[model samples]
Target: MRFTAPVDGEPVGAAITAEPLEDHFGAHSALESALMAAFDNGRNPIRSVCAESIDQNGGKGVVLHSGLFRVDGMEPDRGITA
Candidate 1:
């Protein structure tokens, strides 16, 4: 997957992960494990996310965005999947 941070249509820092989600393991068990790892490690931090998911989750949860992140928490919104 690819993303571009634009400043008047310019690109900035980017990350490339092959089998990214495979490492991520969207499976329930894997997700839970990852959450535990990140939360317990105290390394993950809040990131710049599209406001739409924040609007949808409404503090009940948050959906991870396709931007730089260390991994904290996220939810799912139909068109706003993260």
Candidate 2:
């Protein structure tokens, strides 16, 4: 995946993945996994803005938006999803 730094030009890392899930719940799991990986190993620091995209099962559609904020030992915020 392509990555861009913040306007301040600070280094940031990102991860992106795509997979099929049984339902929205499963999709949530997949997204969470990706987010965890990104924060655990990504170059971005804590509280940095991160984004995730989720695709509905069976090729229905995808919800794309940015609302996730990286924090230790906590869940990301549920931002605008399709």
Candidate 3:
């Protein structure tokens, strides 16, 4: 998913992911590469990017916040009900 900044009409963020592979090797690097490509494409002026995963996914959380992402906000019980 791609979203434009409301004020400037430039891309503010995008959602990207890769298919889960059983091998699990190099997945983090691959995802990072894809993100770099998106930023370096020189088309849309993206200001930020976003991704989602279950709270229990510590590895994904680490990857998301490792290079270019940070914890913004959380929607508690998102897509779930008590």
Please tell me which predicted candidate would have the highest TM-score against the true structure. Answer: 1
Q: What's the residue-level lDDT of 9 in candidate 2?
A: 48
lDDT value for model 3: 0.32
Q: In model 2, how large is the Cα lDDT of residue 18?
A: 31
- List the RMSD of every prediction in angstroms: 12.4, 14.5, 11.5
By TM-score: ranked, best first: 1, 2, 3
Q: Sort the candidates on lDDT, descending order.
A: 1, 2, 3
Give the TM-score comparing model 1 with the true structure, all chains together.
0.23
Q: Deviation in angstroms for 37 in model 1? A: 27
lDDT of 2 by residue, 24-71 (tens): 113345466654454345333223333222111222222222222323
Better by lDDT, candidate 2 or 1: 1
The lDDT per prediction is 0.34, 0.33, 0.32
| Residue-wise C-alpha lDDT for candidate 1, range 19-39, written one tens digit per residue | 323233232233545544433
Error of 1 at 46 (Å): 15
Model 1 residue 44 lDDT score: 23
* TM-score to true structure, per model: 0.23, 0.22, 0.19
Worst 10 residues of 1 by lDDT: 42-51
